[model samples]
Target chain A: MEIKENKKDAVLLLELKGRLDASTSPKFQKKILSVIEGGEKNLVIDFSDLDYISSAGLRVLLLGAKKLQSVDGKIVLACLADHVKEVFDIAGFSVIFPFYDATEDAIKSFE
Target chain B: MHPSELIETNLYREKERTLFYGFIWSAVFLLPKTVAVVLSNSVVLLADLLKSISKCIASLASWLSIRRVAKGKDFSYNFGYGKLENLTSLVLAGVLIISLLVIGYEVYHRFLHPEHIHDFGVWFGLLIVAAKFVIDVYFWHHDRHLAKIDNSPIMVSHWKFYRADAIANGVVILSLIISVVFKNISGIKYVDPIGSIIIAGFLLSSAYGIVSKSLYDLLDGTLEESLQLVILRELAAFFDDYKEFHGIRSRRSGSHLFIDIFLEFDNEKKMGEIYQTIEKIRRRIEKSIPGSNVTITPTRIPFV
Candidate 1:
């Protein structure tokens, strides 16, 4: 999976491409956690190009959400493909993350 | 008890019905086969008699165990009566082993002596066995279906038993055909003993299969990895509602799963909201995994 990282206003945006599964989740975890450790608080993960997510990928997302919750910062998700959204819905992870129709809406939530 | 607390599983009733059919079916043939063994000196008839009697006993044990488990879910047994099914299967496995020894001795004797005498009563008994073989196939297929839906130890054990019984009936039929019809062939009489040995082999294999599976279920621990991930997914989805991850404890009783997840809620979170959150988490997990009960406990200390 390719993770494109940049800042949009005060929000740190990570747009992921390819499948975020057991094979790719660890690398995704490293980058996402490191971004948090680098002191970027408000985060948005764009799943527009992401195709699938297994339970392992879900674990990392939880870990990232928990770490952000420890600080007063937050993480929301954005631009999920239809199939990818279904997975989050089935896992009940949809309720845990603020989901947006577009990356701009997710970044706007922080502002 | 509330209706919601009851497990909606066919894990007991389906297996009970399967065993009941087996019991009644074997009971149908038991007397005639016994008579055949008494009247004939044929090794094949003696093997058939042993198999018929053991089927009656094995089916009765399995049937009674399922009946007990089906109706005996009481507060005294915290995890319900699932383990009773395993114990009874172990008992039936013992029956198979004993029958194996008896058949082995009879076949060995026949190997040394090569007795060829047979009576019409034995022929009539062989006809009954052929009918019972059809019933064996029915139960084999029926138990196989139930085992697929309810992968409980009892159902699986019964499925294996019926499958072996069906094939063994076929072997017994082959031996009867050889002794009753092909006795004039030069070396045909010995095939009767060999057929009994083959039937004994099936019984041994079935016994081994049941013992290994029942023992494993008896010793199984914790929820599997995929199930654990499911619990984690729900927790992650509702991450804001609670504090620390703490831990999850889970185990299976019969076909039911019991899971307890430990989480710390914010001190100031209202009692009503915490209750709602707990209900939401519990309901989602239970919905995702059928025949499962999930409890979310709010606490300050971590408990796994």
Candidate 2:
């Protein structure tokens, strides 16, 4: 998977591409963890090009969400594919992660 | 919202309306039919009355199941109430089988000792049959049209009931005509019993079909071969991503498919990268088979 990071003030916007599975989640997780360690609070993951996500990927997101919660930080998801949204729904992750239709909305929410 | 989702919502509302109307119509007609059976002393009419009763029960059960399923998953029921449809089907099948046996026994007894017609009100029987025919035809057409679009098992089952009732009404009318026309024939008395047997046979076969289908679902049967092929094709495309992958298991619940796969990736690869690869494969599988819940487990060694 490909992840492009854009820093907007205190928020970190990540545009992801390709698949987020067992093989790619570790890299994605490390990237997010490093950003969190750098004291970035608000996170927005843009799933406009993301085609898939499995349980392993979900776990990474959950971990990130929990980590952010500990530091009074927040993570929002945007532009999810229908199937990917369904996965979040089935796994009951929708309640844990707030979803926005666009990255701008996600960034605005962090304010 | 997508157009398809809007259409689906409309269709679901329409289905609920149709089922509610059908249940009300069946109950409204059931009382008079039961009275007719008591007054006419016709085995065919009695069988028809039993069938109507069973249909009403099945309709109510199906409606209840649909309502329960609509409530979605709860703390008590994690998988939702989709299985209620299968459970209702099983109960309906059991009722049908029992009704079939009762009708069959009545037919057999009538063959041994035929009784003289006391109050064989042909006009009364015809009136009840005609009313039933109208109701069955209306619901049958409506249910069939909806079933074609939704293809829900409960809707299909309701359609079967209506179709069988319409056919059974025709048989009852035919038996009535034969008994009335050939009043002098010694075997004319067997017409109604023979009609009951035919109706019983129809019920038995339909019940068998329902029982087998519901039982298969209850047992957690695998998805259709075509769907399994789609999953396999998706997996085949990602063969190089992992060193070895096995233990692909799948089952269907309602309209959703649940898939479990185990993969052994290169040991040197980072965990996040491994997750990304698995996610890609999951996306491919989900695209090929929509509305599937997938679980991917990473293993160090292949299971022997």
Number of the predicted model whose DockQ against the real structure is largest: 1
The number of clashing residue pairs in each candidate reads 0, 26
Q: On residues B1-304, what C-alpha lDDT tens digit does candidate 2 reach at each position? A: 8996687567667767777787788798887887777777788888888887888888887777776665554788755465677788888998898788888877888889885443456667778889889889988888988877665667778888888889888888888778777878877898878888888978988898888877877778766555654665565456457755434667655545688877777778899999999999888887767657788889854332
**lDDT (0-100) at residue B67 of candidate 1?**
80
lDDT score at residue B188, model 2, on the 0-100 scale: 82
Model 2 lDDT per residue over A1-111, tens place? 999999898789999999998689889978987998899889999999999987657756765765576578878999999999987776557766899998899999977
Off by over 4 Å in 2: A1-111, B1-14, B116-120, B144-151, B236-243, B263-304
Candidate 2: Cα lDDT at A102:
83
Instruction: Give per-residue CA lDDT, model 1, range B191-261, as digits (tens).
Output: 87888888888888988988886776667566665776688777876777786565567777776678987
Report per-prediction Cα RMSD to one decimal.
7.4, 16.7
- Scored against the true structure, residue A11 in model 1 reaches a CA lDDT of 89
